[model samples]
Target: MTESWWRDAVIYQIYPRSFADANGDGIGDLPGVRTRLPYLRDLGVDAVWLSPFYLSPQADAGYDVADYRTVDPIFGTVEDARGLVADAHDLGLRVIVDLVPNHSSDQHAWFRQALAEGPGSPLRERYHFRDGRGAEGELPPNDWPSIFGGPAWTRVPDGQWYLHLFAPEQPDFNWDHPAVADEFRTILRFWLDLGVDGFRVDVAHGLVKEAGLPSLGRATEWHLLDVGESPCFDRDGVHDIYRSWRAVLDEYPGERIAVAEAWAPTLDRVADYVRPDELHQAFNFSYLATGWDVESQRTMIDASLDAMGRVGAPATWTLSNHDVVRHTTRLLQRNEGDVAGRKPVEVDPVAGLRRARAASLLLLALPGSAYLYQGEELGLPEVIDLPPEVRQDPAFHRATGQDGYRDGCRVPLPWSGATAPYGFGPDGGPSWLPQPASWAHLSVEAQEGVPGSTLSMYREALALRHKTLTEADSLCWVDTAEGILTFTRGAGFTCTVNMTDRPIEIPHPGVLLIGSGPFDATGDSVTLPPDTTAWWSN
Candidate 1:
């Protein structure tokens, strides 16, 4: 691996609660992840980014961290995490753990002490505690609504309201407090000492808020991807905090890195988080949110490359994560058009998988780091039929403007069985979120070496991607027919995608390396089927 391995590298995201459950507790743990390291290493990814397994109340699915220094019992002990990191390194794979710096669980020792000490206590200053509005102090301090739902501030018995941009269980931290900053730095050192390769900083853009904690002035629901300036997020002050964190990472050996889970109004703003002196990479959400059309895809690709290029940073691309519906299902939904005020549209699974396969080729062919959410490689679709009683996403309870159904994508992975729990744990053991019965065919055991399986396709694409694109950084657009996007990377290497519904003919790029779907070649030109992508080399 190169010194800057993150650049053009593929990182797999593991949502621990659903990745694998080793102890039959129905919850995935560190040991389970350790057992899966070999699978990821074989999958050709350079690193694994584990979502928060930090000591937590499991509110917000562990994003509401109660302690930064220890692993949650549901996941494992501190030593377990240490062992996992060591095991990953031994397998020649890097490990990046999630760091939730923007907020701490309401159950955190600091937050608990602040509540017990009442207002004006020094501990209270570590969080955003403010007096309620109105004569009786009966109203929240501000109009800022939680990203999950309702007001962002939750009132306490002391008549003070504390800010929680997410759920009430997660109180936003006061980064201006010297102690808060010092504590996080200490936490970084703690994990660094444990041999962690880096951190995927959660809510990296929200650590600092605008002064005065002003109101949004109108009713608006905040979605994860909501752009436009906000007083609570993407504040200028957050950069300094990252700059300090960057210094700490540099102190460690092995080119330790930091990635920002930042959502900003534009790619330019997102690029700011990845400035040479700040974090190493920020997710290219714009590219992920782009529609499956040649015009939108090309526009986003160019914009993402340009924005990150200007800052001397490699852009990061991803399709699905723990927070959203899987792309296979999402793309199918898009094809159905607006469902607002309408019954759900029946999704055609075949079409969805085809588009997803084509999309994967496009993602890998791009010139930057790529992230693969677990299960996406197996072509898992969102489990939309999950009973409401089984739903656990905080947003679902809040009924926020956001879809609030992230649980659909968080179901435990299917490994090797044809029944419920499907090798996720001991036979007949429970899963925190139930898996769909149809997953029997999608299980890793089912897809493992099957030539046409999505898993096999991903393995092949990733292997080819690493071999050909790792050392190549240049991407030049190649003129092609309308509804088709084509680009060349290194000499004699080209990637083309057909976005139109009908087959389109284009000049023969070169010897076909791999294709998302079959194509017809006649003499010096090739006919690419709709929703297909192909790579070629001379």
Candidate 2:
């Protein structure tokens, strides 16, 4: 194992709309994020990956980019982004912006030109156009289900069809078209030249539509993208698209990383995205959404590492993010089922922290970069019964209960519930999402001194991780036995997490650098208390 800055880096993702609001308005803006740089710097993340803040109609909450080069009025202006980049750099944090090359908002000038020009037009080719594909181009080319819901293809008013793998508003780009690839290259250079370190590519795996555009293996229900068969994205030659990006990134130094949002089933294909000439790392989502069964987790971790171990880049791991339920909430749901047949997972936010620490130790000890979503350090629980009326995520709206999509993972960062805006907005006027009443007790300020609070434990764990920052490229040697997951980060650093409620023994020990409360793994054998974890640097 060797040292790599990206491997050791802690990248924090900020969903600007929910992070903080400087304006009296309910929504968060760039100014709000600027005010929070000190907080983020205090947290000690190596980088900040800002989600899309580009100009948009908010139809998809910034994912639908109307103009890649400009900031949405709701968020701020181009000058504000410049200031953000400068401020983040001053804080010793690198910056990465969202690169959504797959599609653009219908309001984008390209899409508007496509609407204006019929099929085969220059801009028309920027998006997928297959004649005689759907219900008069309304239905998709196959039975694949869109992640948001419905068929992946839709018809234009001009009687031609375009493909959109996620949302109708997000029309899939025809990466095959040289013009489409050229457009994204320009977009990439636009931001890179603007001083962004790199990009967190949106749906990176799906950039290349399958050449054949095959139909679903089964003909019942929604489109097949969800269940496979529709290989439009993540198809072969996808690397070509990435290679193109890589060639551009190579022009710059600093090892600028491109974290691909690779959501695929097989590891071999996912591994392809991280080849040295392509993406730097793809999201290892299997672990992020795996069932908590120990065997399942071990296999997922081992399988992912084995896959990437054969490749050029390190595999990244994330417990939860903006698109998934908080790991704490998910664990609670699994441990305590049946709350009036709905499940008892909804309200058990208190018990999540210690377990979260144990889990964090479990993930951080693995190979590759560990993504810490905003508020994850606080062991934030999913807001229960988040009413659909206030649901801002387009994934939830499109899925409509089909799959437990993104809404649970996204909630207003609880600055202070007793405060006017829960500490998220200016003058505490209104929050985009209703702040939970429990936030009063769960805020960062409230948990700073409280022993055993999730907030404190997370900060401690992060500090401990800082000690092993040099071991980024280390191999993950895992030992799953005796109700614990033990692994060594490189040769001199070994860590173990006792997930069970009872104390467990350890195989070995060097130095007790850090651990959750009630833990002891001394001299060949020791006890790890219920809900405890330990780290060593020796």
Error of 1 at 234 (Å): 0.9
Q: Give the TM-score of candidate 1.
A: 0.97
lDDT of 1 by residue, 404-487 (tens): 778888899999978989899875687999888899999999999998789988999999997887545588888899989999
- Per-residue error (Å), model 2, residue 49: 0.6
Show model 2 residue runs off by greater than 4 Å.
1-3, 133-141, 220-229, 335-347, 417-420, 449-451, 472-481, 490-492, 505-511, 519-525
Tens digit of lDDT per residue, candidate 2, span 26-108?
A: 88888989999988877777889999999998877889899998999889898889899999988888888997888899899
Candidate 1 lDDT? 0.88
Q: Which ten residues in a row have the lowest lDDT in candidate 2?
A: 335-344
Backbone collisions counted per model? 0, 13
Candidate 1 clash total? 0
* lDDT for model 2: 0.74
Q: Candidate 1: misplaced stretches above 4 Å?
A: 335-346, 399-401, 521-523
